[model samples]
Target: MASLNVYSALVVLFFTRAAAMATKENDQIIKDNNCETKMGLPCVLEAFTSIFKTGTISSKCCGELVGFGKVCHTTLVKRTLENPLFKDLSPARIIVKSIQTWNICLALIDSPSPSA
Candidate 1:
């Protein structure tokens, strides 16, 4: 009976440690994909400001915007953008526009060349 108890305790300890490691890894993944770090406030501000002047989005910005959408999803993006820091910005509009632009860019890339 004592040996059985010891084995049970060891199993519990191993599972608990495994669970903690899994939780840590999940948290790290969330943190890495968060909008503040991935998309960034500065980048948004710059992109919005530049759109009027250039009428273009760089490939880097396009990728980051797409990634933000993929990571945060629509509801989370809306909630996060409701923060006071983003009160003046329209998250829905930006997200929609970004998606549209990304789609257009993707289509252009996938299109066959005139010569081909």
Candidate 2:
């Protein structure tokens, strides 16, 4: 029974990591599509937004989220700070979590995907 409990915990840990990675890739996709439309890539963002569930960004989206790791990060930190979410979150902790999530998706995308 103890062995089974340990195995279950490990599996849970693995899936949690998997989900985090998914979020990261999704973020990149969103950022990419956003840039295209912003720069006047005709019909790309419109086609993406019309179907995207998050109603935010696309799966093929790829690009550096502007102002990330710099002023934007600091800006979000301040915003999340004043907002109720970060009263306990703290800026550093939230950033660490964001990195971890991004890494997860990157790992999947980098891996030997079955389709390949």
TM-score of each model, paired residue for residue: 0.36, 0.31
lDDT minimum window of 10 residues, candidate 2: 59-68
Q: What is the C-alpha RMSD, rounded to one decimal, of candidate 2?
A: 15.9
Root-mean-square deviation of each candidate, in angstroms? 12.2, 15.9
**lDDT for each residue of candidate 1 in 1-116, tens digit (9 for 90 to 100):** 99999999999999979756755655555566664565766556544544312356566665555666544433344444444676677656667754565575456545665884
For model 2, how does the per-residue alpha-carbon lDDT over 68-98 read when each residue is reduced to its tens digit?
A: 2233333333333445543565557656544
True lDDT of residue 63, candidate 1: 56
In angstroms, how far off is 75's CA in candidate 1?
9.4
Residues forming the 10-long window of minimal summed lDDT in candidate 1: 45-54
Top candidate, metric lDDT: 1
lDDT of 2: 0.43
Misplaced by over 4 Å in model 2 are 35-116
Model 2: lDDT of residue 42 = 30
Cα-lDDT of candidate 1? 0.57
On TM-score, the candidate that comes out on top is 1
